[model samples]
Target: MELLYSNILPLGCDDDERTIVGCFKEQMKNSDRVEIAVGYTSNASLNELDALIDRYAIKKICLTIGMYYIEGMPERSYHTALRVNQHWKASGIGEIRIVKPFKYHGKLFCFYKNEKPFSAIIGSANLGVIKLEATNRRQYEISALTINETEVAEIAFHIEQLKTSICSGNISDIKGMPLIRETNTSLDGIELVTAVPQSSVEFYKNCKTYVSFFLKLKVPRSVDRHIDDGKHYTKSNINVCYAAPRNKRKSRDWYETQLTVGSDIYRMEGYPNKNEPFFVVTDDGYWFKAHTTSDNNKQFSAVGDELIMGRWLKGRLVAAGIVKHVNDTALDADRLGMITEEMLEEYGCDSLLFKKTGQTALDEKGTDLDVWMLSFVSGNDYER
Candidate 1:
């Protein structure tokens, strides 16, 4: 039996970059060349690929560049493929082709020993600066590899056909590729509003009705050492259109993202999503904010500092707690082994804090903290 289809994302992502790149290195170690075809391409991504080719000393390389209609496509063609088109020729990479003016959007890779193909990868990921340079917690891509001889032959044949037909000259030799205007960054100076008033602890506690993004924003001790604030009212002015996990540049259209702490607004962008991205304190203690994943469906389990916040007050460090399903009967105050009566009195919290333990498990409900974290910030920074 042989492995057929395999996931490439977990290979390149998850702090295990060696797996994905190593896959190529291993292939290059045994093979003479690998072919890369992407409807969209960029210089930064190409540079990384070129480095790999050089390191393995893969003798032959070919590229098929195209202009696919996709979001995040570079605005200018020359700034993209055209510039890279000129850069690769000096190297041992001998084969390159440019295709455009057509709605071409496909990514393919074929690795070969001599001229025969042994492995190939195909998918929706564009070989662009964003994909090659950074691996976000999540991306707009899905790719897989097929090592079956039959599949590799079919892929190889397709590449040869593309070269004979659409692959005409380098990006510079092509006529239509042009320079275009640049798009502005959307994250700069954006506005957001709270979905519910900060005091409305019930809004965060009741996951069934609100089922919203759980945002953990840190308030500066200088700004509001909110040792005392209770839950209260609710309202929202903005809606979340997108979320940026820390990887791809955090640029979106107006009102695309919003993270809020007290009255301050922070744009969520180019950051990784973490399971436990909660409390963060700076060196001077002049500024601080809670961190949450870019997920849009997180709910808070009133386990921390809740006893201190009481019924109706506000302060920094007002609440600390675990995340859990509201209906999970195991989530009761007594079931929470960490909190004691004396501790609750000392913290001045009414409910026992439910700190998430290593033994904690994710709820079957779609309330993954990743979804809720982004929602929390976006809602608070949303517009009316």
Candidate 2:
């Protein structure tokens, strides 16, 4: 048995081997599967674990999260977990489960080799201890690493008990659970902006320079037939941008999200130019750098990173509870993966409105750029 303390030394000087993340990685080196039961966790922690899973060639990870039964999980975290589970499920990697009926505050991680428990970490650290972010403050945690065969088996048994159908349920089960509708709204790191009410005629009257377009385009029934007729079909515009093609050879697929703009709209005086990046503050308070590119400057996308724009728009819908969260594994036939006309209609709005705020802000590189506001609120009726 070995004791581990996260803050034995000064903040940044602590030994990486003693920290939760480092300890987990070291254990993963000898194990192919792991089972974790933590009081609470975050999306960042899951992302960290996901990376480790690939790096270590982990075959499976079974996570049983507690605390959500007492204090509802944050909507973002819940949705992120769902998306992560979807990926894992599609890949036959693992599953994430939630405790039920009673609250469990224990934190334990058991690593297995060839389906036999070999080691375990019992501690005070939640899954968040693994995330190494600049903004996250280091937390003090005391845990024990035990390789004793008897102790490892005992701890593994407890976790297995928690996995029983009666004791816990898969993350997907929450969707049908009565308490699933209750989600904590305390979104950390995300700014929530109060949108100008669409019913406010005065606000619309004063906003004349705005451009609005539908999120889901009306696609012809047969794209192949259309191509046969010499029509160029850009799948990026028809489907949600986040699911952009993974074809490395095609420059169009390189841009994750591409929404086609009308020539008149793209040619608007003072609008952003081709490849000229600008800051965008969405009505939902998400901010990103954006630019117009492609032939005729008709493709609007987030500057540099491709997933930013799609995440912003799709994330908003997920938060609104109007759409299900999805990942790259989501198929085109999975309506949950793509923004469909039906989703927009259910959201009570079919288009997004973009208007230059007439403001300027310095980007990460310290370049001054125009700031634009994007609104996708329901009932918003904007003129072309």
Tell me the spans in candidate 1 whose CA falls farther than 4 Å from its real position: 1-22, 68-77, 129-137, 165-167, 183-384
Question: Candidate 2: RMSD over Cα atoms?
Answer: 11.4
* lDDT at position 318, candidate 2: 68
Candidate 1: tens digits of C-alpha lDDT, residues 1-384: 122222344444444322333454566677788777777665466666666667777788888765532233333333444334545667646655766546456787789987889987676656552234444324445556678899899989887777765444554454434333232222123222112333433233333322222234221222222222322110011111122223354422222222222211123332323334332211111111123333331322121322111111111112212111122222332322222233223222322111211121233343333212212111112211
In terms of TM-score, how similar is model 1 to the real structure? 0.40
Can you write out model 2's per-residue Cα lDDT over 106-138, one digit (the tens) per residue? 999999999999999998888888884553455
- Total clashing pairs for each candidate: 47, 0
State the displacement of the C-alpha of residue 205, model 2, in Å, after optimal TM-score superposition. 25
TM-score of each: 0.40, 0.53
